[model samples]
Target: MNPFDPTVHLPDELLERIRERAPIHDRDNTFPEQDLEELRAAGYLSILVPAARGGAGLSLAQAAILQQRLASAAPATALAINMHLVWTGVAKVFSDRGVPGLEFVQDGAVAGEVFAFGISEAGNDLVLFGSDTEAAPTADGGYAFTGTKIFTSLAPVWTKLGLHGLDTTSPDAPKLVFAFVERTDAITTSDDWDTLGMRATQSRTTRLNGAVADAAHVVRRIDAGPGPDPIVFGIFSVFEILLASVYTGIARRAIDLAVHAASSRRSKKTGAAYSQDPDIRWRIADMGLAYDALPPQIAALARDVDERVDNGARWFVLLSGVKHRAITMAKHVVDQAMLVGGGGSYFSSNELSRLYRDVLAGAFHPSDPESAHATAASAWLGPLES
Candidate 1:
């Protein structure tokens, strides 16, 4: 009955340890330093790297399964670690596609270096397609990034930042340059991550005032937003799937807790458990019904990615669709769980309450509801009247 029963190499005890610390980190608004450390010790950071590269050599589907399990224990921790996995997963995608670039990413993961995703910028609805940051080319062919990156997860201890910027000074003009910048004096993490629910992510704002990436680390220079480039496809495909997995895990945890609460909480008038009530049972069944479609969908897409199955132009729609569904289902299931949990679930301290808050974050992630709808519509019905 446990969806997290898939043992994808993540130890049960390690998960429990992380789960035990989730509340404290959430309450104190601190990064899960110890959780990260334990994960590192477990070799979790390198799950996507090839075995030859000193990693577990797990496929994207396997990693997704593990991520879902991790999220169930600690959603914030799962989300924070998602940034690191994004880079590693990207590296795996490149390797599979025979792209020479991003091997350094795999190597770094094997070395236990934490890589954070820095693609987000204020007013940049394009996600990976556009960047507000300036990628000033250094005389030596590297880049000096100057701009503000919002929602930079793993802020407290990221060793390298995987980000992109606009190269306006180049002959091409406005090409998005991808590279990695090591943590340095030029990079500053703003103390401004006070948030609802997934507070433990500590995805603080990072101001890169001439944060430098050497020429060697500069990987791609491509046109941004909806391209056939492997780099773009790799990042988008891996990111959305893993992100969906995390939220799916949160949904699972919420339903499990609701089941326990519904069974134990008694109705004063009836002198019986609330679980006996048909409405409460129906709510739980509805939650399960919404949840039933997600895991298989996530797994199938992830496997398709790993197997190099081409969905043609349908890739974006498919990827975004599953992500959208997973998050929406998660939010719906959590809402149902709260209703079934009765008034006690209203308090912030309740686990169900935390799940309620955490699930709200799904709407804000990339390829949000509007974007997902647009993407899917474009795929099925063609573009709207110009």
Candidate 2:
């Protein structure tokens, strides 16, 4: 296949259109359905589904680059779509490793089916290691999931919900079930999604009451706590890397905005552009230095996953660290951009102001500051004496 060129799939014109709609969605606190429609029409929804499976057949690294570009234009749109891409990315992991279960996911994406991530639960810090939700096996090989999933992106339009729960009734007596269920009557999506940033995501709460995943859709049943399961690795690796790409893109946009502000805004004292000011130059340079450090890290790690390079147990640390770094760096760059943007950026209508708000949501995503620190600490210092 030809080297994945992002501009081919996501043209400058398409991105400009999406960028134009971002503030409208943010202001109205509405999902960017038009953005989704354009992306879907452009075959972006199936970018990783493998060329043979009728997709763009891009690697995870390529996907990361594309997502960063997409996020630069409309962060909330990119973020909302990231959930759908996560499942597909996981399916790619399965296919690449000679696994057979997730072909349906690839096919589903090609068929224009939208998949929503439904893993997050309130107060469940165990994350991928455990689940507070219940998963009961049915007479058939399927399982029924009952729980409430918080922060379910693509809540309004997902045709299938991919989620997990704990099954205590089987002989194993405590297995984590990862499965997918169609959006039937058993599932309810709450209308509560108001937030300070990324408002266009419309990532509302999801309630699963006896939602059944047929045998085919039931992907994995593994021992609860973190283990050497491929599913676990696939989810974590793709999720963290893709997430880092989004925030890194946010930082990239901030840098561009800062450059524009510095060039366009002039100081009354010298009647010269802010770009000529020593302090502003230093700030922009600092932002560039910080931002330049992340994409390579993301690309290398993503390439490792793509090429099946075993990073061993350090994989989690690396993934979480990159995500943590990306968000924190993005926040810093946006802060700098706000300063360079002058008092006008403080207004709600300013793009820099929107970016400031959007960047805040990065801290709340997985591998949060606390969890990222905990993972890194455990990796380097070993588990604390308990």
Candidate 3:
């Protein structure tokens, strides 16, 4: 089995194509069709699939590195790609169980079909907790999922969807199942993703009224587990790191632009270059310092994950801390980049603007800064008796 290598990842050519299409994608707030096509062609969409199942057998750490590299070129493309990779990881978790609806997920991955998470719902303040969507068990032993899922990121191009919910009628239903649904079976609404940043993600609304899902499509229930699976935990940790990495990439790009602009642009009064100014140099230095601190912190977290998996320890607190630290660092880096880049960074033409917006998205994700901090603090306070 070939191990996934971020350094040797061959998606550079594909990423270059995404970069070419980014401006148009952003301008129109449309999905990066070209980018998705290239990713599918380059086998990037299935990078998380197991080796036996024809995937690249990449580790979470490697995936994080690759995401950062890709994000440097295009954050929206990286976001869409990340969603696909996450869904693929989810599919791998169910692969061994011979889950019904999930076979199509594997099939879609092999066939270059994209996947997205349909978690966020309309009028739901809390994405995870307040899902209005109901999964009712039918007489036929299948489930009928009827609800609207808003912010369905990457839905326009995704071939499959990962649906998360509980039995609405039975609020205390002991199990929570993450269902893998075929996109064709669900009704999709267009252009619902109107945001200040990451507009190119094409995260629209999906109406899944009466969508059918069977035992095969419905994977394992949450209560079926005794301990957290290392692979699943590792993958979740990777997502946190990847979120930071994408912002780190954006920050780096902003620094590069700032450097180039400072070196070339001269001060009118002093006849000195901006790069030669003490203030500009200090700001740039601050950006560099922030960027430098991220990799080591995130790498440390990834190493901790690897160590825990190796030692067979369940450390949910560690994962929470990693997510909290990485996201905080990402915010700091992006903020510093904006400060160093100055007013010109406000323009859409400036990559810094996009990076700024992309970094903001991290602050709002499910494992957001506030929740992560609370989780870590609670863990430090001591475990509560169940």
Strongest candidate by TM-score: 2
What's model 1's overall lDDT? 0.92
Q: How well is each residue in 1-386 modelled by candidate 1, as lDDT tens digits?
A: 33434454678888889999998898899999999998998899999999998999888998999999999999999999999999999899999989888989999998999999999999899889989999999999999999999999999999999999999998888799999999999999999999887999999999999999998899899986668888799889999999999999999999999999999999998999988999899999999999999999999999999999999999999999999999999999999988888888999888888888888999999989999999989998999988
What is the C-alpha lDDT profile of model 2 across 41-144, one tens digit per residue? 99999999999999988999999999999999999999999999999999999999998899999999999999999999999999898998999999999999
Model 1 regions more than 4 Å off: 1-8
Model 2 TM-score relative to the real fold: 0.99
**Please, what is the whole-model Cα lDDT of each candidate in the order they appear?**
0.92, 0.95, 0.68
Model 3: residues with Cα > 4 Å off, grouped in runs = 1-7, 91-104, 122-131, 168-174, 223-235, 303-314, 383-386
The 10-residue segment of model 1 with minimum total lDDT is 1-10
Give per-residue lDDT, candidate 3, residue 126: 47
lDDT (tens digit, per residue) of candidate 3 on 299-352: 666555434344333254555555565556666767766766678888887777
Best by lDDT: 2
Cα error of candidate 3 at position 341, Å? 3.1
Candidate 2 vs 3: which has more lDDT: 2
TM-score of 3: 0.84
Cα RMSD of predicted structure 1: 2.1
Clashing pairs in 3: 100-216, 100-217, 101-216, 101-217
